[model samples]
Target: MERSYPRDPEWEAMPDVGLEVWPHSPPDTAAYGEARAQALQAPEVEKPFSENLANEALDIPRSQERALSYRVSALMASLARLNHCDDEPTQADMRLIQEQRMLVAMQLAGSPSLQQRLTNPAWVADCWSDALASLGAIGVRVENLPEDCPWDQDALLDGPQPNGRNR
Candidate 1:
C-alpha cells in the first residue's frame, strides 16, 4: 500500500539541505485525480444530488474532526493487535504504521512549539521565500502560503496533507 508522488525534474535538481523534504508532486494528486477529472466533466445541473449535498454536509471543522477520529481508531486497533506481537510486522502492518506516522506529523505541524520553530525569524528569513517558490513551481497554489508570520492554528493546519502517502 506504499505510495509515492509523481516524479518531477525540478524536485530532483533542488539540493536536499534538510530544511524541508519537498514532495515530488502535490500530495494525494494521483489518488483523487480521477475524481477531480470527473467533477470537471459533470456540469453542476447534471451532477448527482448526493454529490452536491455531500459538499455542504461537511465543512472544514467537521472534516478535521472526522479525520482525527479515524486516525485514533486505526491507532487503537494497531496497538491492540501489536500487544501480543512477537515477530516483524507484515507489509500491511508497516503501511498502517507509516500512515499513522504521517497523520501524526501533520497533526504536530499545528502544535505551538513546531509552529514557533517554523516561524522563527532566523530560519524563516532564510528559507520562507525559497520554500514558497519551490511549492509554486510544482503547481501548488501560492494561495496556500500564509499571509504573515506566526500563522494562526487554522492556517497552519489548513494546507495540503500527505493523505497516508508513505513519502
Candidate 2:
C-alpha cells in the first residue's frame, strides 16, 4: 500500500527569521493524529505476566554490546562494499570534495563562534588554509560569495582560490 503523509491543518508560518517565544498555532486541531497511530497497533493479547516481563526487561550491557557490535559490523560491511565496487573516486573527484570542504570550512571559520580564532595565524595554518589556497585557486568575487559568507573568509580578499577564482 502507498503511504500518505498524514495532514496537519493548522501549521501557520511566521514571516521573519528571529527566535520565537511560543508556537503561534498548534498543528493538531482535531487531535485525531494519535488516534490514527494507535489504531495501527495490534491489540494486546492475554499473555502470561512472566512472558511479558521477560520481553519488557532488557540486559543493558548486552544491548550496548549489540549496538557497538553492529556499529563495527557496519564499518566492516562498508569496507567490504568499497572493496567490491568497480569504480572509485578519481583524484579530480577527491580534489573537488576537498575544495568544497575548504569552502565550507571557510564559512565555518568566519562564524561568530570562531570570531576570536579567525585572525590567529595558528587557526589559519591548522585548517591548512594557505596550503589549500596555493593549490587550486577558485576565482569567485567577494560580493558573489554565499550570503552569510565572510568578507575575507580565507586567504586575502584579492587573491584567487588555489586554482584561480580571482583571475
Candidate whose lDDT is highest: 1
Top of the candidates by TM-score: 1
lDDT of 2 by residue, 119-164 (tens): 6555433333333332224332223222221223343322232322
Off by over 4 Å in 2: 4-98, 129-158, 161-167
For candidate 1, report its TM-score: 0.28
lDDT of each: 0.44, 0.34
**Where is model 2 poorest over a 10-residue stretch in terms of lDDT?**
140-149
Error of 2 at 24 (Å): 14
RMSD of each: 21.4, 19.2
TM-score of every prediction relative to native? 0.28, 0.23
